[model samples]
Target: MPAAGRLLAERHKDHRKRHPLLPAEYEDEQLAVVEVTALWESESASGAVLLEDSELTGYVLGAPKPSPVWGPNLWVEAAGQAVREPEHIRDLYAAAAAKWVDDGRTVQYVVVPDDADLLDAWFRSGFGAQHAHAVRPAPTTRLEPPAGLKVRRALRDDIAVLAELDLVLPKYQSRSPVFSAGELPTLEEALADWEESIDDQDYATFVAEYDGRVIGMSVGCSVEKSSAHSGLARPDNAGFLGYAAVLPEARGHGAGRALGEAVMQWSADTGYTAVVADWRVTNLLASRTWPRLGFQQTFHRLHRAIGY
Candidate 1:
């Protein structure tokens, strides 16, 4: 296994398949994948650090729990790379695996039916099949909320309010940080820069207001994969109801559901045939709400860590 990533680039094909939408800068970001690995190495998430060779030619990433110790994740040198030496690679992951099993820990796994071979390898290696992650389908057509909360297209001025709401919601500390506090666009800033995001097509956000405040929101985007048809080979036509949040005070009043329903209708009316929304495993409200509005529970992406 000699520097195969550069010499036999094709061997890294599995990694590419694992992350198809990986931007050109696959290795960098504020929450860069590289930094995630390094930061969690000793944290709960680092299950075990295995090196293909004692020289550290290849390694694995995993985070063990307790304190959600090192961020639990895994990575290795590109498969075809020179570090693919069987004994070394096995020993490397084996060390981590031993620690994981002995520690009485479990890791979460997300897989597609088509990745049978990969799943086989994973299970054979002791990765248990956790509960399948689920998503909700967007409304197939546009439909209004119960008609009193005032559903309207979001205005430039509303970004601040919505951005404000974004600030107060519970921060789901998952492996991938899609909604960090700093990532939120301020109202005034988002207003001035609204034009920049509009041209992306199939991008729109709706809001529900009561007493002059942006009480609830329903934002949709076409960039995500849908729950109905997941294979990459399938045609892409669905969108995701990216943001559907309601203030706590508005919960039982049906504001959350209204906002969500309105967004599904908007998507359906706007030509999107499907809508998908992601909810953390612990969000009892979302887990229950979407299914009530014909948003069939689809799949989930779990977060786990290793360590005590």
Candidate 2:
């Protein structure tokens, strides 16, 4: 475990050397040690450790997700892997995949740092980019919304519209190329969620209105509140832009970009230094919008499915 932690620390150090904006706190080996130990001790844990000359060179571990959305899925979480050499990752994954497939976990996902060599190695192991987690410095000024468009905090009266806009993302993902099979939330579910979050101290919801009709919405919260991002290294006092969607008719009017800027401005006003967001890599609109908004990729979720 200690050797694996050391390897992870070294890898993070190298990543920081290339991308200095990444959080520096993770360079501590003990943090990796604790993280690796917890994953190793998890009930569903399955893994492989590579040893050369009685010395640990690399390791890979994963556990099956209970979520029905991901049937027979094995998730190699952010801290689930480390290696002394980028090429060593292929060998570690080869060993881990055999055990995972034999156990009937045919769909696998791994969260890997945004290192070119590391990503290439995983690609060679038959994984392709599936999702991305990214961050950008909070903006001091909000971008101006398009003419006749008003952006403001969401209200109870906007719940129906907010709920309607929320479905835009998942519905789009279900179409060609993306093919995200996760069940879509009903309007009732989305309305209930917004009602609970509307006045919550931890959440901030924004809406874009055109001709007094809500056409887009966005939500922001602390990074600590996001399970997908909390496990990874992030800038101190980072906020998360958790959700954003605009109606199809509002697409070219700059509603999406305006909502993003509003979220960044909110993060800045709320004392956050940076803001993080994630999206499916194959979601064409999001894949292009996020990077253009100055969010640099920090990690990639690579996926591979066997026999299905």
**lDDT of candidates 1 onward, in order:** 0.48, 0.87
What's the lDDT for candidate 2? 0.87
Task: Tell me the lDDT of model 2 at 8.
Answer: 80
Error of 1 at 225 (Å): 8.2
Model 1 lDDT tens row, 131-239 = 2223334454447667567788777667666665554344432223333222444556644555455344556777887766678777776635334233321224556
Per-residue lDDT of candidate 2, residues 153-176 (tens digit): 998998889889989999999997
Indicate which candidate wins on lDDT: 2
For model 1, what is the alpha-carbon lDDT of residue 202? Answer: 59
Ten residues in a row with the worst lDDT in model 2? 227-236
Candidate 1: lDDT of 223?
Answer: 38
lDDT of 2 at 242: 91
